[model samples]
Each structure stands twice: as C-alpha cells, then as structure tokens.
Target: MNIPYAIPECRVAHLVERHHDHLVVPVRLDAATGCCPECGHASRSVHSRYHRQPADLPLSTSQTKLRIEVRRFYCLNPTCRRRIFAKTPTDLLAPHARRTRRLGEAQARVGLACGGAGGARLLAHLHMPASRATVLRLVTRMPMPDTPAPIRVGIDDWAIRKGSRYGTIVVDLDRHRVVDLLPDRTAPTVAGWLERHSSVALVAWDRSTEYARGASLGAPQAQQVADRWHLLTNMRQAVERWLHGAHARLRSLPLLPGSTVRPARRNRAFARSTTELEAAAQSRMRWQVVYDEVRHRHAAGKPLLAIARALGLARATVRKYASAETFPARLPHGAGPSLLDPHVAYLAGRIDEGSENAMALWREIREQGYPGTSRQVHRFVAERRTRPVRSGRKPRSAKASASEPPGSETLLPPARQLAWLLVQPTSVLNESEAAVVSRVEQDDTARAVTGLARRFTALVRAAGKGNPVADDRDAAADIEAWITKARTCEAPAIATFASGLEADIAAVRAALMEPWSSGQAEGQVNRLKLIKRQCYGRAGLNLLKRRMVLAA
Candidate 1:
C-alpha cells in the first residue's frame, strides 16, 4: 500500500510488519545526492545501505513506526575531507534521534503547554507516549526566540527557597514579556546582567537596597522608579504603627458622656482544651526548670556555650534563657485526635435540625461507627449550649448617655481595621464605615494622617493615569507638604514614616512622577510561582528559566 505522507522525501516500499497495537512500514528515500555536511559538497556515489527504524505519530488509534532504508555516499570532492557519510533524511529525523521530527515537535508542544508530568500524561492519552523526562528534554532543547534589549524594564526578586535563597527577574514593561532571569538577587549578579543589556533606560523596582545598588552599578544611565504599590503599602504600615502606639489613648477616649467601655470578645476556639491545658502546664514546668538553671549558671559567670554544654541545650537557647527577665510563655500543644472530630459535621447537622438531645445523638453516631462514650458527647453538647449568643445591642459603658444615637454605642474597631478604613477612599465607604471614619477623624492625629494618606493616594492614582498632580515640581511640592504635615503631627508613627519617606524622597518622587512601575515584574513573579507549583517544585533554576523564556 502507498503511504505518501508517511515521511518527508520518502515513500513507503511495503508493509514490513503489523501487530495488534501498532504497524511498521518499510520506506526508502527517493534516490538523490545529499550535500556533504563537513564541506557542503553534493555527492551521489553510493557506499552502503542499512535499515533504520524510528517511531512516528500515531496512525488513528495505533502507533506507527517507520523502517527506513538509509544509504551512505562517498564525498565527490577531493578537498572535502574525502570520506563516507550517512544519508539520513534531515527534514524527517535528526541524527540518531529515536522519533520523527514531527513526533518530536508534537511532544515539545505538549511539554510547552502542560510542563513535564502533565505533558507526559497528555501525550499518553493521545497515543503518543513519552516520559516526563523526555518531554522536558525536548522542551529544553527547543530554541528560544531572540528578543532585543528592552528600553524600559522592571526588576524584582523571587524566592528559590523562600527566606534562604532568592533570584531576580527582569521584565520588559513596554512589551510585557520577561527579558531574563538572574540566578541570584545579589547586586553584582543583577548589575552584570544589566551591563550586558545596555539599552535599559528606566528601571522600576521595589525598595530593596540591593536592587537599588545593582541598578545604579549595572545601568547607571537608567532612571530608577520605585513601585507605587510598595510605596502605598509602606505608608499604610506607618499608619498602622501610629495607631498601635495610640491604642491606649484611643481606648480611654469617651464615646459619649457617661458611657462605659467593654473588653473585646475572646476567641473560644483559641482557648486551650483540658488535655492541652495539662500539656502546656507540663511544658511550662520544663521550661521554668531550664530557665532557672540558665539564670543560676549565668549568675555564676559561666559562658553561654559552657552552660549549653552542661545543660545539653543549644547555645542560642541557653543565651535566650539567660538574658530573659521572665520565663517565656509556653505555647499550647495543637489539637489532638478526638472521637468527635469525625462526627463534627454530623453533630452540627443534627443540632441544626433540632436534634439537641446528646443521648440520642450519641446513639445515632454509634450506629454510624462512633466508638466514643455518651459522656463525651454530653460535654460537647453542654459547651455548645453555654456558648454566648451576640445581641443586636452594641456593648456600651454605663457612663454613655441613653440619648446616644442608635448603632453609635459600639466602641471603635481594632487599630488595624481602623487603619484599613483610613486607607480606603471615603467615597467608596458605606454609611456605617463613613461614620467610623468620622469618629476616627475626631482624633487629631488620626485626622491629620488620614488627610495625608488620601492626598498621597490621589498622587499615586494620578501618576498611574499619566496625569500627575501638575508637573514634576508641583508633585514634589505636594509630597513635601504631606511630609511636613506628617512630621509635625502628634502621631509618632506618622512622624517615623515621614522620616523614612524623607530618606527615600527621590525614589518616592520618582514613584509619583514616573510612568514606569514594577507591576509587570510582580505579575511575572506570580506566574513563576504558578509554574513552580505545577512542576511540584522539582524543576531546577535552569529548567525554570528555559520554560519561562520559551513559554513567554
């Protein structure tokens, strides 16, 4: 049977073999002269012939294998390193390759789309089985398309092993593609990469001192722009710190005349269970014994290492205990296995359905495979029965006036929540949230910080839209005004933040004026994380880089 499309530059000679799962077709190249690879000279003199078999793309549901009759030819030119050469079909297969070029291309596409294991599984389903390693090999061997040096780029670090190891990623913000991945986040490493690609003009990055130094050293001509998101984040953190510092004063402030203050609700789930309480007590006793020993030894002028050796504790632990003024609180052991855990959902459903009798529930669970005694179920039920139900009326102090507005009796939320509200625009807040903002603004420090935060937010928003507040000078003036107000405010948190902003004033100004940002680079980092997780964290740096560049 004739098979014209079986392989390039070859025709099927005959059906050599057939099996239940696959078929083998013997094919021969149309007689022709091939160029000598070493000298680029065409030669037709036949030297030898041999059969070579290679796997091809699946034919319908069965695998197809091509058995080709290959030939050897003698070099015709005398100066062409005169010798014999194999006449393999270059377009059909690469030298010594076990699969056809088309099949390899298909496998590579699978690898590119789904990665290693996923690609292997997909190929197997498509009747083109290949191992995960093979798929990755094909992907790595695929040539990457060349990209020119980017003009505007963003640089940021991603963790290889979080907190211990990190690498840098450079992205072309204009084209929205990855430029390259650096092996380390060090200044010299990034600087070296930047020096090689001298086309970089503007570099937007986070407020990392290492990256700042690298950008300066590598691409000194490039203007560095701080990330807007990071700037806002820093400002928010400062506001939170200020609020934390003023927590006591804020708590003592009067909500209304004659109003009393109530303590915040405690998390019942966070409370230690009976078993955990016992474990914590034992742990505390053990730590106390160690702490007393360390203190005694330290008082006797024993070295930390000597104390550690004598006590069989780590030197750091010994030093920590020696310097500590009081015994550290022991953390409670985590919840252990319980008979009720497996039946918790069932118990909840039963309670919701009005089955409140612990005895009946216990019997029902027993029928469903529970082994616990009825007494345990009764205790769980009793706890649930005694749990407090929150009332609609907000808790208030007796000193608060009875004439206070409805829903105005509650004390302010935690400082963090209050800071979050302050960060958001008042226009987007609902009535209650707006009221909270008003109450917070009544505090002189909060009000001043809130105003400055809103103005900075507006500046950032305007810069994002390419319509910054006036020109760069006016924008600088606005920043200066905000900083001045912040530094003078009663809130120490805001003042501390302002001092930091003053130190990085140039980067902050660039952040508010420059159109460039590390937004794209951050997005690519997220993409890298996803790819890393998909590979189950087994891929190395080189493999990850290859995948990212080719996939990008």
Candidate 2:
C-alpha cells in the first residue's frame, strides 16, 4: 500500500487495524541507514527494533494514527561514546512528540487566528480533536518573524481590564503594523522599550504625560507629535464646559422678534398622562412626615442614630431633617436634546397657520433636514392642543420687555449639542441653526472661543491634507497667536485649556507641523481590543502578543 505524500519519508507496510472512527496504518522508514548524532557516522547495523505510535493528520474524515517500526542502530566507530542511537523521522515528527509536524503546524495556525477555546471548537468541527490548552501551547511555541527598526512610530494605551489595568501598543506607522505590546502603560516600561529602538525618528501619541516623559527620556532626538484629533476633542470639551456655565444666562436671553413663541399655559392632558402632580404630592408628604418625626425626636433629646433606628431612616437622612433649613425643592430631570429641536419652531408656526396635521408637518420638516419620527411630532401636536388657555381679557405679547436681553427667552441647546453646533462649519448649518449660532457668537466670550476653535480646526485640516499652511514655522506662529488670544479671552475655561496646551506646546506644535499622527496607533489599539475580546479575556499577554504580531 502507498502512504500519503505528506509523510513521504516513510512507506506504508500494511493496514494494521480499522475502527468505527479511526484508521491505523503500520509504516517503516524507507532509508536503509541512519546517521549518528554524535559523530555523524552512517550505520546500517541494527541494534534493536521497536513499534512507535504517533497521531497523524486526519484521513478521509477519520482519525489516523501511524504505527511505525523504528530501528535503533549501533555506532560503527569504536571511539564513539554512544553505543546505540534511535532512528527518528525528522520530517514526520519531533522526538517524543505524539503528533506529526504538519498537524502541529495546522493547529498552531488555527490557534493564532482564533484564541485557545475558540480554536479548539473550530478544530473539533474539522474532526481534528485538540484541547484549548494544547492549542494555546502551540501558539506560544510558534516563532515570530524579525521586524525592521521603525523610523516613524505611534504609541497608545489599551485596557487589559478597563478602568483598572492598561497596557501600551506600539505601531510602526510607515509599515502600518503593530511592532510591540508593552506589559504596562507606565513611563519606565515604555522608556525601556523605546531605548532599544533608537532608529525611531518621529513618535506620535495623544496627550499622555507618561508617554511624553518616556519618549523624551528614551528617544530625545525623536520628534513627538500630538494627535490632532485629540487636540480638537480637548478644545471641544473646554467649549462645552464654558457653555454649561453660561446655561442660566442663555435661559434668560430674549427671543428674536417673529420667533415662534410658546404660551405659558399648563398642559392639563400631559399632566394627567404623566401623573406628575401625584408623584410630587406623594414625595412631599413622605418628606414632611420624616421632617416632623426628626424634629420631635431631636426635641426629646434622642441621639441621631436612635431616631434613625426608631423611624427606619438613615442617620444622614435624620440629620438632614433635624437641621434648621428650608426644604429643598426636588428638580425634575431634564429631557435629552433631540435632533428635531432646530425644526420645532417651524413646526409650531405650521400648526398656528392651521396646518394641524402632524403627518404633514413631519413630511415638511423631513424635507428641511429633520431626522426624527412622526410619532414625536404627533406627541408634540397632541400636547399643544391640550394647553389650558387663560379665561380673561386678551393677553399681552409673550415677548420679553426691552429691559431683557434679546434672545434670552430662547434656551440654548445642552452643552454637548451647543458645542457640536459651534464647531460645525456655517455652510453646513440650516437657517435656524445658523441664526442660533449667530446669536451665540454675538457674545464676546463665545465669539472669542469660536474663533479660536475655527482657527485650530483649519490648522488640523491643513495638516491632515498636506496643505502649505502646515509649514513648521508658520504653524508654530499660528498656534502661538491662538494661545495668546485664548489667554486674553474673557472665557475662563478657554484660558485654562490654553494654559494646558502651552505647557505641552512642543508636542502640540509637532501636531500642527508634522504630518504623522496617532490615528494608526489608535486603529491598532481597537484591533487589539477585538482580539482580546475574542479570547473571552482569558489569554495572557505573551499569547496575545504572538497572535497580534503573527496574525498581522
């Protein structure tokens, strides 16, 4: 019988046995003589013979095991220390190994692609039985190809366990491949690795102090470039903070003339549907009972804890009620901002003009860039119709008095939404959004912040697109000018944010001047997360590193 071509060094002598799910083939080495390991002497004289069993790759959907008759040869040289040496098939199987080299190679590849448990399941599907631990061992034993020194690199941190432990991933930006994964996200760990790769010319990263310090210590000659996306994101967060602080002022601003004005009447139907009044009354009654009990207990000279235990209240609650202060009003949770906000005024106008059909209003707004449901419009219209009108003489205009600031009645969008609006290019905003943004820009503080934000965005776009404005000296000067403006601007939040940028000015300047970015590094981190999650977070760092480098 002829053996398969995969194990060509051995020829099949005969079929030894056949079972329901497995086939056993007895084979022998085709070579007439074997070479001695110690002296490289070829010997044909056999000392003894033994049967060896090793598992081979599956044959025709059935498990195949080879029962080979291996021979032990006596050394012909008199001076040789070894008397007898066993003949082993180097191409078929390693010494003392239970499986063929080809089968082990396939298992290792499967382990690299899918992690241990996943790979085991996959192998089972292919009728190649292997355990998760075996697959993991094969993966760890797999060799890694040597990589060249990186000239342009990006570094970023990824969570091993989010909010608890994190590690760093280093990427070769020019090659667009991950180079190494450090054990921890500390300065010493990163610095130790960077010190070994002195050929790195440019290092791109986010505003992480640990990375900055490590890069400076290890690769002082390398230019450090901060990510433009991170810089813009930080600036947006600062703008949002300032907007949140100014929310009260924005709430008091008067609406512009001819703007859709909401009447100050209670919605009886909405109140009934929500049971809001009943909830408030129950809360008030509960708090009042607690307050009366606490005051009585305090007057009786009972300790706070005793009063708490007697009344089944927490000590903190009892102390709060015992304190002589006015009852604090419970504020209702605010509704989240909706995409339909910009068109709500237009919807109200259409309803006032006697087009009370909600579906028609939804279609009109859809044409005007409203990305919301007709159900939301229907709810709005239904509530508006149930407003309780005042039964008296004709009311005065709902517009604010001249003493009030113009546009005060128009509440600004939430901080995040307002920040998004401010950062958006004016050409993209609809008529209503543009007007709102224009009104906000009229404020000196808001105008200063918006101007700085726009300038920074232009710089980033220019750098990303390789425009001429990204010239190192020119970009540096522009950044300095913006920082000066920020410091002098009336917005304290903007000034604080600028101060932080000034401290990291070198990295920030590199961000504007150099074309390299941490974008590629960030992408690698995301890929790492995917691989980590695939293993159900059971694979260790060494196993994960092998998968990342080899799989890439």
Candidate 3:
C-alpha cells in the first residue's frame, strides 16, 4: 500500500491493520545512515532495531497510528560523546514524542481556538482523541511566531479581575495586531515594555497618568496621543455630573404641548409613607455627617488610614468620601423586573377602562398567561390609587375630557437623560428629544453647557474623521479657546474637567493631530476577554498571554 502521509526517507512496509475504530500503518525508515546529535558524526553500521509507534491524523473514520521501524546506529567516531543514535525522520516527528509534527501542530491550533476542555471534546469527535491536559500541553509546546517591530503602538488597561486587578494590552497600531500583554498596569511595567520596543515612534493611550508617565520615561522620542473617544467620554461624564447638581431646574422647565406631565400630590405623605420619608431623611443626615467629617479631616492634613480608623470605616470608603467635589447622593433602591412585568401594559389598559378590582385584573392577566399572584396586581393598583383626591370639585364634561388623550400626564426627563440629549448631535435627536433640548436651552446656564458640549463633540468628531486641517496651529488655537471658555464657565464640574484637559495639553494636542488612536487596542482587549473566559480561570497569565499572542 502507498503511504498517504509524507514521512521523509520512510516507506510503508506492511498493509494497514484495522482494529475496532483504530487503523495502524507500519512504516520503515529507508535512510542508510544516522547522524550523531552530540558530535554530528554519521554512521552506517546498525547496532539495533526497534519500533516506535506515534499517533497521526485521522484516516476516514478511524484513528491512524504510524508504527515506524527505527534503527539505532553505532557511532563510527570514537571521539563522539554518544555511543549510539537513532535513525528517524526528524522532519516528520520530534524525538521522544508520541505524535507526528503535523499532528501536534493541528492539536495546538485546536487548543488555541477552543480552550483546553473545549478542544478535547472537539478532538474526540474528530477521531483524534486527547485529554484537556494533553491539548494544553501541545499548545504550550508550540512555538510562538516572531512579531515584526512596531512603529506605532497603543496601550490600554484591561480588567483581569474586574474592579480589582487589571493588566495592560499592547497593540501594534500600524499592523493592527496585539504585540504583548503585561501582568500589571503599573508605570514601571509599561515603561519596561516600551523600552524593549524602541522602534515605536508614536504611542497612543488614554488620559491615565500612569500610561503617560510610562511612555515619557520609556520612549521620550515617541509622541504620546490621548484617545479621542476617551476625551469625549470624560466630557459626557462632566456634563452628567453638572446636571446632577442642577436637576431641580429641569423639573420646573416647561413641558412640550403634547408631552406628559407627572401629577403632583396634594399630600406629600401620599407619595411615600411617612415612615419611609423619615428613614430616608435620617439616612441622608447620617451620610452628610460622615461626608463632612471625612472632608474636614482630609482638609486638615489627616491621612486616609487615620481617618478610616477614627471613623471605623474602610480606607477605600474614607478615600472615596474625601475625593468627591460634591457629596455623593445615596442611590435609590430599584427592584428587579417581576413575573408581572410582561403584563403591565394589559393591566394599565384594564385600570384605565375603570376596572378597579384587583382580583378581576389578576384574572384577566392570568387568562393572558401571567404567572404572578393577585397580590402583585394589588400593589400596582394601590400605588396608582394613592394620588390625592379632589373634594367637592365639579366633574369635567364628557366632551372636554374626550379632547385629551387617556392617561396623558406630564413627565419630565431625568438629569442623566437630559445630559445625554445635550451632548448628542442635533441631527441624531428625535422629535421628543429635540423638544426637550429646546426647552432646556431656554435657560442661560443650560444653553451655555449645551453649546460647549456640542462644540467639543464636533471638534472630536472632526479630528477623528481625519479631515484636512487648515493648519495645526489653527486647530490648537480652537481647542485652546474652547478650553478657556470651559475653564471660566459658570458650571464648576465642566470647568474642572476642562482644567484637566489643559494639564494634559501635549497629549490632547497630539490626539487632534494624529490619526492613530487606541480604538484598535480596545478591540484587542475585547478579544482577550473572550479568550480569558474560555480558560475558565484554570489557565494562568503565561498561558493566557500565549493564546492571545498566537490565536486569531
């Protein structure tokens, strides 16, 4: 039978033997001499003969194994350190290996694409059986391809263990491939990496000071460019923060002609139980006391450790309280969606139709496949019924009531929602969003904030599109002018944000001029996260680094 595989200097001697699901092919070496690996001496005299069986790729529906008849030749050179050497096809298989070179490569690729256990399950179905451990071993033994030197690179931090540990991912911006992964996001770690890649002429990063310092220390000749996306993101956050403090104004803004407005309660106690209000007030007061004490202690030159100890609080908590420019509001508790959520629209329709009975509403929903109890429907009806009732008021005529739509109530957008509308381009805003924007713009402070946010967004988009600039100096001047306006603006949050930009002026300016950004680096981080999840936490940093650098 002819040999299906290309085994150098070898020939198929015996016919294929089929045993259950296995197919074995006996192979014989045809080489006349063997070379000594120790001294490079060739010998033709044979000392012994033996068989070495190694697994190969599957054949049809059966696992194939090559039973290679190998010869052990005596070294002709007495000066050689080795007494004997094996005559085998080195190109086909590695010494002391149980699989051919081609087979090992296939398994390594499988291991990389599908992690350990996943690869093993896949290989078993393909008739090339291997354990998870074996698959990982193949992946580790596989050599890494050499990467070309990079001219432009972007660095970003990725969460290894979110909210706690983080690592750095370095991507070659020009080639659009990951170059290396660091164990930590520290400046020293990043600097050491950059120092090794001296070919890098430009380094793109975020507004992080650690990355900025690292690039400066490692590659001073390389110009650092801040990511444009991150700049806009930070601006959006500043707008949101400012809106949080000025949210009361948003409530008083005039509603659109057809917009819904929330009805006010005559009795404030009806909004929430008196007990709930008192509890919330007491909680807020406690937070205010702690917040004030922490700020005062910090202002008086007290260390975070001392403050935490004195307050019986964690260092992180104390530090958070001290770092805030404004007091952090306690987040309201929001309940998760219930089994009754899908039936809310149906329930509302019944309620508006004058069906006030909770059991009746529950029965109607149950017919529609709602699995929740009547108590859930009862709570919903009770909340809606708690609005203050008018005593002895004249009822509206049927014609007057029919003029307005049913359930139409005035609803004011929240501060967070308003902040988003302000920063977004007008072209993307819908009719309702545009109406909200128009109303907010009526106030001088809101209009100014909106103008500055829109202008900043436009600048970043223009820079990102790589439009031809009239002059680098002109673009810088525009940015500088915007910064000046933002710094002296009435909004303190935005002013502080603008001051931070002025502090990182060099990198920010480079961001406007250079086309390179960390966008591709962020994409690589996403891919890394996928691979990390595949490992199921069994793989360590070294293995993860190998898979990321090698896998597609």
Candidate 4:
C-alpha cells in the first residue's frame, strides 16, 4: 500500500511506501479535529501527537512504516468527566497493540507455516525480525476463517490421539476448509454443532451412524451422501461376516494345494517385461492345473483323502475344491449312459464279456497300469454296476457308496457336494449335508450372498471382541484396538461402521478417545508456518496464507 505524504505542498507522490510486514497511515488532529471515537463525547483540545503504528504489507523490500499522528483528547461532556484517552484508529487493531494490523496478520502466516522457531528464524533472515513467541502468539490469537453459512456440509471424525480420543471436523463443501470442530465425535456432540450452524443442505460423510444421528438431529433437512468408500468398507466387513458364520462348516478339512514352481532369485533370469494382466493370468494358471486334477479325481470315484495325500495337500484345501459347488446340493439325476463317462464303455464291454464282479474289473484295470489305489478302481467298477438292469445288476450297495462322502481328511477344496456340506448345520446327516453343500457350491447367487454374510458376521465378531475370559482388561484393550483399525480405514463404509459402533467402542475410549477427528486440519495450520518460512525471504502475510491454503 502507498501513502500519499504532504508537507503542506508536495510536487507529486514520489516515494511509494511498501510494507514487508504491515502498512501504516498518518492521521492529523487538532482542537478542531473530528468527532470523539469513544463514549460519543465531543472533544475540543489536543494533548499531543505522533505517527502511531498501523498494519502494513509484510515481505516488502523497504521497511514500510505507518506514519499516524496519534492523539490524546479531553471529553467536553460535563456528564462524562473523563480526563484523557488515546484515540483509536479505524482499521485493524484491538486495543494497545504496538504492531499494526497488517503486521499481526503477517505474524499469523509465518507462525502457522513453519511454526514458531522456524518462522522466527526466517523472519530474522528478512529485514524485520521477531521472536518465535511473538509469532506463536499471533498464530493463536488471530481469528479463524469465518465465511458465512454453507448450504452443503461434510462431516467426519479423525483421531487426535488414536484409540484414545476423537474430534469432529466439519467442512463447508462449497468453501472447502475448516468450518468448526466438536469436542467429541459422538452423535449428540456433532448434532449440537449442526444445530448451531444448521443450514446444511447435504451432509456427505462416511457411514458412521454417530454422524448420521448428528446430521439428523442438527440439520434435519439435509440429505446424507454416504461416501462410496464407506459403503465398500461396510460391504467388505459383511463378507468377512459370512466367513465367520461358516467356520463351523469347515469341520471336515482338506489338504491345501502346493505350488510347483518358484521365482528366480537372479535379477537377470527374472521376467521383468511381463504386463500386469499376463502375470496375473500366469498366477491363476498355476492353481488351475491343480484344480482340474482334483475335480477330475473327484468325478472319477477317487476319494478326496487319497487324492490330497497323493498331491501332498491339506485335507481342508482338498475339501474346499471338492465343495466348490454351491449350497443346497443337487441330486446326481442326469440320465447319462453311465454314472462315469470314461469308464462306461469299459464297464459295458466288461459286462458284455460276463465279467460282473468288482474284483474282475480291478484286476483288469491293474493290468492297464492304473497308478491310483485299488479302492478307487473298485469304486469306479462298482459305480458301473449301480447304473440299471438293462446293462447289468445295479447294486444298492454300489449306489450308496457313490452317494457317500469321502471321509479322508486333507485340507483340499471340497467337491461341489462337500462345499454345501461345510455351510450346513451339524445336526444334518452326512448325505443331506453333502447334498446341501453341493447345492451351495454350484449356485453362484447363493455363494455370493453367503460370502457377504460371512464377511459381515466376521466384522461384527471382531468388533465385539474385548477382554475375553482368556485375558483380563487386555480383552477390553483388544476391542479398542480393533475399533481403531476400523477407524483408520480411508473407506467411508469402514469408518462409518466404526462410527456406528461408537456406543460400544470400548471402556478406554468410552470417554476421551476419538475414532476420527480434524487434527490434520489444525496440523495444516501449523504447516502454513513452515511453507512461509521456506519462502519468507520476504513475503506478505495475506499472500502467505493464500499460498498455504491453495498449496495444501
């Protein structure tokens, strides 16, 4: 800012007063000066005058100074009887400040950017010097941003001291900065803030019901925009739920599949040029072979136990594949030529040749180099006898054996039948369980639903965990830890779930702990000081604040 100076007569405004910290202006007063600023009392005699400090532009090259003619006046009103008062100026100042308004604002920028010490160091590097304490005081005392009421607001909670306390940071979506903060992220606390500042047209927040309750309470008219991230998080937790609920069903474990290949340790031997999709496809391909072999053996009357042992896998994993079929198992009712496709021709020819017993077929198969165990050969040959009367005697024993589940325990993927069995209640029969597991493993729709159910149940279970009987107060501490994990997720649904669980968030966080808060917003205020420090070789406070906000 440039002040036009005069000594009764000036050629022109030759000197442009530029302020690096703040700008100052001179005001003249005499017995005939102007109206009294305080008490509305008229004054007529002047005490004395000099240039009083006023706000100026910080970061200016020249040591810009305010040349104000300060004055003391006597109240003429008999009723008031005041002796003398220092007349105040119109621009920016509280009372008794030696620094100008511009200078104070400048201090705010520097203090907030680099912090006190950093700002002080940088300021000293410039012409005008000040202590870190002075800079910090300005940062604290300066007014926060106060734009008028907003139509749309965003509410969220963030941790100040994680697992201990949380604070709410509200933002006017339209302006996009700090609106206000609540002491706690609880429903009522946030609701109160909303009620006080209630013009919000929309409340965009993560899926936490605390904020939801607050939004409902404070800004009843506002529409809630549940963040997509929150929704996904909730959905994922829901899937985990089904996994938990299905835990009991996993009783009959199978063998796990092992990898046949390993990555090369030498950099030069590694395949670096592969694309992401190609690499993923190869990874899938590795498991696909094992999956195919397992399914084939399952269909061929080789029990999961034998195959898992042969393949060196956990029984549970073998069961997983075997039970890949959807729940509510379907009956093997197809009217095929034989129960076994590849074995049917052999069975028909053997039956035609009058070789009827299981021993004869097993003996014949052994001569053909069957590497698998004899029991599988028996099961397959017996399956042939169970078909119908037109070809041969269809034995009830053979039929029952076909329907029976392979009790071999290795953690393998369940056959379509076993998957349904795993999801069923324990009260059911093995045959019925097998049928149901088969149904579930086959129906994509049912499987999808169960997956979601599993995840949700898991999350709930996780949330409920506290000091279990196994632990002491550590159980309570454990619950708090889980909730903290839930809160930190950037996804809205996850945060919202954690928020909704606010009531049961745990004993430790029950009081001072915050799951979410706007401490980062406050941190940004401090960061503004660092940014200012880095660039404050010479800069104005207004420019600094603007830069900090924009850059941030």
Report the lDDT tens digits of candidate 4 across residue range 1-552.
Answer: 344332221121234444555443444432344355556776657776555554344334444444556667776766664666666554544576676666677766766667667878877766456787787677766665557887776667654445677666566666656566556789998778777776767666765768777877888886665553343344445333333324334534332234212222211111112264367557667766777777788889998799999998877566555544323121223223422334545756887676767666766665665444555445544544544545555654554544434541222222333433343344454643444444444444335444433433343333334322234354446445655665655333345555555553332222122222223344544554455456543534444444444333
> By TM-score, how accurate is candidate 4?
0.44
Q: What would the per-residue lDDT of candidate 1 be over residues 1-552, giving only the tens digit for each residue?
A: 765365788887886578888878888898688778899888889999898889998877778889999988999889877598888888999889899999998999888778899999999988899999999999988887788779999999999888678999989999999878888999999889889989999889898879888988999998888998998887777776666556445544555433343323221122334576568679878888888998999999999899998888987577556654565443222335677678877887777786667799999999999997987776555444423224433322221224233333355666567787898888989866777677677777778889888877777777888886667788789899888878897766678778877877777888887777999999999999998988998988877887788788
lDDT of 2 by residue, 93-138 (tens): 8889998888898888998888889999999877677999999998
Candidate 4, lDDT over the whole model: 0.52
Per-residue C-alpha lDDT of model 3 across residues 321-432, encoded as one tens digit per residue? 7766666564333335578777877777777877756788899889989886787776566555423224532322332334333322333355566788999999999977
Residue runs of model 3 more than 4 Å from their true location after superposition: 38-41, 78-83, 248-355, 364-373, 383-412, 438-444
Q: Which ten residues in a row have the lowest lDDT in candidate 1?
A: 263-272
TM-score for candidate 3, residues paired by index: 0.82
* Candidate 4: residue 292 Cα off by (Å): 37
lDDT of 2: 0.79
Which candidate gets the maximum lDDT versus the true structure?
A: 3
Clashes of 1: 5
Q: How far in Å is the alpha carbon of 26 misplaced in model 4? A: 9.5
The lDDT for every candidate, in the order shown, is 0.78, 0.79, 0.81, 0.52
